[model samples]
Target: MSKITRIKGFADYFPPESEAFTFMENAARDVFSRYGYRELRTPVLEKTELFARSIGEETDVVKKEMYTFPDRKDRSLTLRPEATAGVMRSYIESGLATREPYSKLFTFGPMFRYERPQKGRMRQFHQINAECLGLTEPAVDAEVVAMLWQFLSSIRIPNLSLEINTLGCRECRPAYNEALKAYLDSVPEDGWCEDCLRRKSTNPLRVLDCKVPGCKALVDDAPALVDSVCEECSDHFGQVLAHLDAIEIPYTVNKRLVRGLDYYNRTTFEVTSGEIGSQSAVAGGGRYDGLIRDLGGPDQPGIGFACGMERLLLLLPEEEAPRPDAYLAILDEAGMARGFLILQAMRARGVIAEMSPTPKSVKAMMRQANRLRSRFCLLMGPDEIARDVVQVKNLDSGDQNDFSVTSESDLDALADFLR
Candidate 1:
């Protein structure tokens, strides 16, 4: 028989890394809630059409990366490659907008994509997403970006910078697309990457987002979408920048910062870190005014962002695991019985308490307690049990005291002392 191993590109998180995951999640909940956002959990699996219709069918995510399969009844299902599509599906199906026109929702969970794995990129990764629905105002865009900025800052992700761009609304985008496509066509085909070659005819905007060195160099002199937007889009983006400025959020207007999503329009933004190499973007999003209606719901506007947890984790400083408040060491059967009761009492009183499950020599138990990094150690043995008391040792100060365990009141006093 062979031992089973984890699938490639899937990872197992342990102590410190898992703790960091929790820390980031708690920070997201805290900062997002301050901005009137509530949690919304959607399933990881959805109809394949949900993504194909929401995220553009020509996009790389749909063309190459999705983990799609068929169920017993032959209906296609896909493990979500990103969160926004599922969120939109849920919003439309649940009539969320009818209930609360201005709904701000956040969610944190795993997303699956079948792509080449690299540092900070995995097949099964996690994301922290927030969506602001039912508003089309530029100020709302600014506010959503600000909230995302605050959440990342609160978690202390290092070397952060903000870059923003506008993809232009449907009315003005076609012109820019044609202009960009003409520029791409003039460039010799030999210089473009395979994907860019296909994209030039399919979706020209994605060429600017191409990371290939040759493709990037070719698009260097390409027309800027920001320079081509209509008056309304220009005004909308200007206001978004103004609001960010009013709130003291610094940003750079990168004309080439078109995010890799088809639904975005008007105001798109991304936050990158210098600490992470090449794939530096830790978070990005923008206004998607047409997604709600596209997903078969009433026409509503939305803006949101998603932070890649794996990428953000790369920027997080090393953290230590939490220490236990107390560890109970029992030296004999009698001590084991009493220590178990005391452990329960201490836990009931909110102390982070743990006890040895079986009898062990005092030295062995004490070593186990030390390994746990407990702040204090409670020792009980035949002698101590006979006296109806437990010896409490402050692991930090090397001080010892005896607490009675003969009565319920004694147990209360013992717990109080531990607290």
Candidate 2:
């Protein structure tokens, strides 16, 4: 017999840890809804070609990290490595464009990537995704970034720093790519890492994102993308910054922050927190003005961000699980029958009540109630049943009172008494 264990890169949230996940989901729902974003859910698996087409075959996610395989019918399906692609697919498949001009949406669930597992990074991870579609205004870009900041603040996440960058649109990115390529070609081959060497020819922009210290040193003085952006891109980037300033959102413009996706163009931003170790970015997103059309959807502008849940969980303060209002203890068969009816009636009245499942000693039931941190224990014994009342004991205060349980009026009085 072998002992069962969880897979290395997956997580099993338990007890207080699960509580933290709930807190994040609830908080995200509240904040997203307040900003007029409705919740959307899509399938965990998608067509493999979707990634190769939208995320780019040259990128790391499609080329090296996606969890892709052929199903029984000989069609390729993949566990989603990221979310935006799937959302676009759904929008197109559902004919949402004919129905609505734009959609403000948010979704959160598991995402898979076959990368090495590290602290705050996982092969199977979770993300809180928010997107605003059909709008290309620079002000929307600023609003999306501000919404992300507000969410982090609402969760009590600490020490966050905002990094913003502009990846020139189709009109200007080609020249910047050529300039970047020229610089990479001028550098000695010895300084480049194996990944950078490949990306140099395939996707020259990715060379700037390499983490190898030697590779980074070689690209240190490469031409900044911001400098190569055309007039429209420059003006849009400037307005994004101005809007951030108008709202008092502090930021640093990072010239080297080319996000790890091929779909992004103009206005890329990341929010990093000091608490999450070297995997510092808790949230990131950018404008993908061309992706909806690229993915066979209506041509519309979209901007969004995703927060890493495991990383955010690391920084969230421990939250106490809520306690039940009352526990019903049944002492004998006669009392059990009466208590069952009372339990349902109490619940119908919106009282959070539970009963001992089986016949147990009064002392054992009391202990169980205490373990659950219930506020009160309703004791139903032979004497209490004959008297048509219950012994209500306040577990915290150790005070006891007799409450009538004979009729609906009595139950209403009991409910009022408890309140």
Candidate 3:
């Protein structure tokens, strides 16, 4: 009777799209490791309180966007809205303080936040998070930002602009909040979002995250967090800027740019690009120097950032993605079995090859190969098997050759051709 349908704000990453995700993951992993960061993985399902405490109770993620449910033991659990909390939970629980100042750690996986589906934001999203714990120097901030820039360059995502801000330390924020709230409270009541109205009381800083034009215009004269940074924080922010300039990476200080999390403190930054509109935020992260100890660790200082994989994938240029070099097509029933064996051989030998299990007409298979844009197609038919060889066709140039299938030596030739 009723047609089955997927839920709102959920999506599947098909094979073609997976290419970009994988490239981004690999690029991030390489960069983090090069910086001496290790990998730390935590469960996708975390205690509900972890995020509630870290992101803040009034934040959208905790107030309305988290995907939380009862576990088998009736304990509250949540599909992680973000990965940093899980990492914090692990560091404290696993006694990582013993490895104090753990540098350059990374995790790449899915993140869930049940918010309105927009251009870049998603209910079920993915992130390539790189965290460097136990470091608070502004130089650390520069390194983290540099790594992000290098990652985007590696993936050929263009036009990345950097916007950074200092949320100030605990001391500076209170005064700034008072000023910001005063400005917002002065605005006509009709201009603010219902959520902003709530924030005006609970977490006044988030009023800036609102998209309402009238609300934004009203806060235009609001106190800037950067200008209000305490002397020490101002120095740290200045040092981070100096490091960026020393390394030739340009940035702009946007005082109103508060990362939508309560734990984020000092040196917050975002990378944006035109390729992914409206959701153009390709990456963002900041120093959460206090989160480790707050989560239960022994007062360890750390700073790190996490980049959104889905957003980066959306922004990546087409030719930059890594794609399969070959699609092996089997033309008849007998060829299907042999084709699978060849597929195994190609993969074992490091060939970027693909395959279709079912046999199809030569015309249909050829069309499929072309549609996939495979550089080469290896076609094996009963006729070729009798000759104890396979037909290797280069789709790029329409060149054809025959090779014996009896040895690894023969497959090496195919692999080389695909290369």
Best by TM-score: 1
lDDT of 1 by residue, 24-78 (tens): 9999999999999999999999999999999999999999999999999999999
The local lDDT score (0 to 100) that residue 180 gets in candidate 2 is 93
Off by over 4 Å in 3: 1-3, 188-190, 320-347, 352-387, 391-402, 405-419
Residue runs of model 2 more than 4 Å from their true location after superposition: 416-419
- RMSD in angstroms between candidate 2 and the native structure over all alpha carbons: 1.7
lDDT of 3 by residue, 28-140 (tens): 77877888878777799989989888888878779898899998899999999999999888878878768654656789888998778877677888888888877778998
- TM-score of each model, paired residue for residue: 0.98, 0.95, 0.87
Q: After best superposition, candidate 1 residue 252: deviation in angstroms?
A: 0.7
Residue-wise C-alpha lDDT for candidate 2, range 1-419, written one tens digit per residue: 99999998999989788888888999999988888999999999999999898999999999999999999999999999999999989888988778887889999999999999988889999999998999999999999999999999999999999999999999899989999999999998878999999999999999998878898888879999998999999999999999999999999999999889899999999999988667799999999999989988788999999999999988998777878888999898877888999888888787888888887898999999999999899998889989989999999899999999888998887776555
Residue 401's lDDT within candidate 2 is 96
Assess each prediction's global lDDT (C-alpha) against the native: 0.91, 0.91, 0.83
How much RMSD separates candidate 3 from the native structure? 3.2
**What's the lDDT for residue 185 in model 1?**
94
In candidate 2, position 366 carries an lDDT of 94
